[model samples]
Target chain A: MKKKLVLYLLFPISFVACDNPAPEKKTEKIHLEKVNSNTDILAENPEIKLVGSRGFSYDFNDERFMQFYDLPVKNLHISIVDDQQHIQRLAMDLPKDKEAVNTLKTQLNKAYGQPGEDAGNDFSAFEEGDVLVWKGKDRLIAMITSKDFATAAKIEKAPKIDILFVKPEETNN
Target chain B: MNKLYTGALLGLAIAASSCGSKKIKIESINNRQQLDSVIALLPKTQVKVDSIPVRVLYMHLKGDFTFYGQPVKEFSIQTKDEQLQACTFDIEKGASDVLQQLENENGTGFKEYSNPILSWSTLPKKIQFSVQDFDGDLLTLSNKEKAAISLYFNNPVNNRITNIYKEIPPVTTTNDYQLEVDNSECGYRLYVNDFLVIDHAGARTLGVTADINPYLVKGKQQKVTVELLPGNDYDGNPRNRLHLESVVHVALKKSSKRSMFSSVVFDFRTPNADSMVREDAHSSRYIRASKFYGQLSAKVDHPFETDAVPYELPCYAAAVTDIRTIPDAKEKILAHYRKLQQAYLEKDSLQLEKLLYPLEKNLQTAWYWSKPIDGQTRWTNIMDKAREARDVKLEENVVLYTTPDGHFAKLLPAVYNKNPAFYLSKEDGFYPLDYYVNIDKNGDVQFAID
Candidate 1:
């Protein structure tokens, strides 16, 4: 009788084990907030925030292109003018942190692809201020400004940037 | 009696095992069918975001479908809070009917539905349905309903970014331009038309003057075509290697009333061959002594007059009928000349080869040798010997002139000579007097005689 009972118990146990399998492990979920208030987002991620209030405006005669990201704020300003007489003005808000600067550089590299490949790193982050100036074709001028106000104030402004034609071999196009 | 008891026991055991196994099998099948129905309704569907029709379906059903080598018909799930959020599903015939039945059960909250029958003819063989929420209701359907039903799902609402350009009326200003390019393996042929013209290749950039100039007639809406051929193996992939930075084509309504003289000024400098020779031979003692003596005598006499005169007679234009080197001689001296000719024809030289080659060769040879007694210096003597051997050939009366009206003109002898200078005038019948008069009187002239 004990043997029969043991056999019956074994069979039922095996059936139950096979019937109920372990449940799947779940993933942690994150709730995303809207990016409507730039200031609010900037406050939360201050490391990636733009340091200054003044940002450059770009107007391309060919409106087909809407916005370009990560372009050296300087190069994007001069590519538009057709005449030597017109003047161009540009400004940029630099990132405060090293990570942000690196990300910005990467983004600009991707955006400019060939044209920006040979462009030297003209940007610098110092204790006081940061500013860049350059002359482009046809009297077009480019300027870059960053807040980290103290850093900007401390920086020694570079001489006016002259438009240099990159040799054919050096150009990415 | 023992046999009968054993048989009875065996029969009972077999019946029990059979009953247990059948029940488990049925339960497992039922569980699977339920899961499949849930999967069929998992895809998110709302509004189409793109003009192009795109749909994605996920599901888990019993069959031969596998992804990334896993036995899954569909398995996509994400949870928020403690709620069991199931946003993915698997759909087969039976499972789809069950889902529809659930939709009907919760008519108020769960209003979404999908086609019960899967149409394999569509590009993607599945349709997806999604409900805002599920309220712990077990979906069920009859065997017959399951047999006729198939699961379908719809894709989630897509939110891909697209570029949109604001409409701007085409400007008709004379400043607008277009560049028509014939890009070939060897180089590019650029045609500039419209407002602004820019021809940039290699390191050189050439722009057309907007103001009406003699070489370019303004207001006429002139078309300038430039052929940029690759430099001799200066780099690789000559054709695709060149880039166009920008182009402008302009049509001036009234050609700028600029005088031809003001638009084009002739700047000529008579290269002092004697000075050049002296400078090049400065390192040599023989050259220094000769140059010192020559300068002293030149100051006493009219150095310009003596230096200008040729000891040998100038090679007449009549000496050779053709001014071209023979094909055989092309390999000898014509190699460098051919390069210069090419640069002149192209009208752009970034390598400065056109300016450097002839001057460099002359300077090198002049400094390296001592003065010869027979008017045969090392470099000059080589040319003399080459001419005798017929290795260097030249043609006579070969007229050289720039066109659109001869802006410049020269005559070459058929035979090579150390001093190869010759002149012509209206009186000579063979020369065009009108063209000569058009050139500025101050234009330089140097004669080399053989």
Candidate 2:
């Protein structure tokens, strides 16, 4: 009888002792490429050179005011997700050169016909700059003239054109 | 042996079950005072704000400011024989018309002219002038045109020039000049005597207003020029076409303790697009890069002294130089910016409050002395912004700018150029939160609220 009592008591304890159950749900880690580091960005876009970097953002050297069809590229900025190693955004800063801006408009018109309905909503920084947008099946290209109005009332810096290329799904509009 | 084994197993199971069932005693307070008494025994966790000596200029700027990129070369002024002080004439020629004539039934008329040559530097402040009549009523003129009428005072004794004009108020030391600008289509820069006093650029449909006293030179002709900046449309094209909504309005008002009434000293406004322009003339004043539509210039004579307190401040350049002397100052500053970015990313209000304490305190002291404190809501909004910042990263380069008096300084992320680095992400996208930070006497980088 004592042995029978021991078996009954041990049965509940044995159920509690079975601690391991089905594993809990976990987030699946994501992996991305062409944005691992400055080296990777340089390797992917051989046309440009790296200038500086901080965290997941990288600046490209464009000292000579490199031209991509009349838009004098002053510099390039690339942002990435550090943990996932994914490219979040890429922007090319254009010089505040009006002549160049005029020329680029002509060049863009020649290359990709007249622009369609306003696609300025693709980027967050499109509030003040003159914007030209081109939409393709899988890609969206936008040219923006950005301004720095945060300074005092006296210092008016010329607005620089920024050309942004991104996947269609990445944009809000 | 079996009984002893069963007894030991039972003891182990009971011990384990008892360990899991241990209950924590939670005391419930019945009233606020009871809770307060219980909390009085705890240590204080509130951050203490360190008071630092600094001079502040209370400047308030409000306006409908926009940027429609254009240079100030579109406007000019000249005085004949150098009799009048330079920039003494205020010109209000329409963008498309340099000469607009007015005629009335009373046979009273005046030919409007721009770039007029005048010689009247020695004339008294209250010179007589005449106005043209339109339909038995006074022919209304823009403040700029009215102010420019002074240039026509060739001979003060001439009755024709003095018939219907109102006398300009004399300027005094305590007088303040309030400047207001409204531009819906583009941004602009306002220059007082070639010194840039307002740069409202790259924005649309904004009105800016501020006191022009600090920027004005007393006893000198105040030259106020607005240069139109190029703006973009909904599709990012240059906004060169005039719509019903497009308009530009600029006015300057003069007031003082000695006078109960504030008189407009300068004004300029685009004619109502709905009434003035048809399909044919739409592009006349709205033309991109057109000199006619891109520049506005005016001049007013302020013969009294202005208060210099706004211009005078402690040297901020020295503070910047001193901060640079610290070991790894650049790294430290970058770290500070990163710390802020991280704090916002994590929605850490305590850390943000600690970091922003100096700024909040200075602002309270400078701007909110008479108001009640409501920091909780402010902190909540700040934390919400932090959570909305999304995926933000600190840029490598930091740029510093200082006030001319060297009393205040602000740091900017090179990526943002003139703006600070902390951008609050929103449903529409990201916009920067204005922060002017400096290294205090204690060598800690804190917000400079000026």
User: What is candidate 2's lDDT per residue for B1-450, written digit by digit as tens?
Assistant: 345445544643554375452111011111222212222322343211223224311111111111111111111112233222122222233311211221111111221211121121222221212322211112223323321333221212212112112221212234567778877655555655444455554445455886655345434455666555554544446554333334456777765433223456757654433333344644534432222344332222223332332221122332454554466655656667677777887877667777766555443322222222134334435555776776655545766544443433445555323334455566767756445556666667765442
All DockQ scores: 0.02, 0.01
lDDT of 1 by residue, B377-431 (tens): 2222322222233111223333342222222223333332222223121222221
Per-model TM-score of chain B: 0.15, 0.37
> Each model's C-alpha lDDT?
0.25, 0.41
Q: Which candidate's TM-score is highest?
A: 2
True contacts kept of 2: 0.01
Task: Report the C-alpha lDDT of model 2 over A39-66, residue by residue, as the tens digit.
Answer: 3443333333344332345554333323
CAPRI quality of model 1:
incorrect
Residue B167, model 1, lDDT: 15
TM-score computed on alpha carbons, candidate 2? 0.30
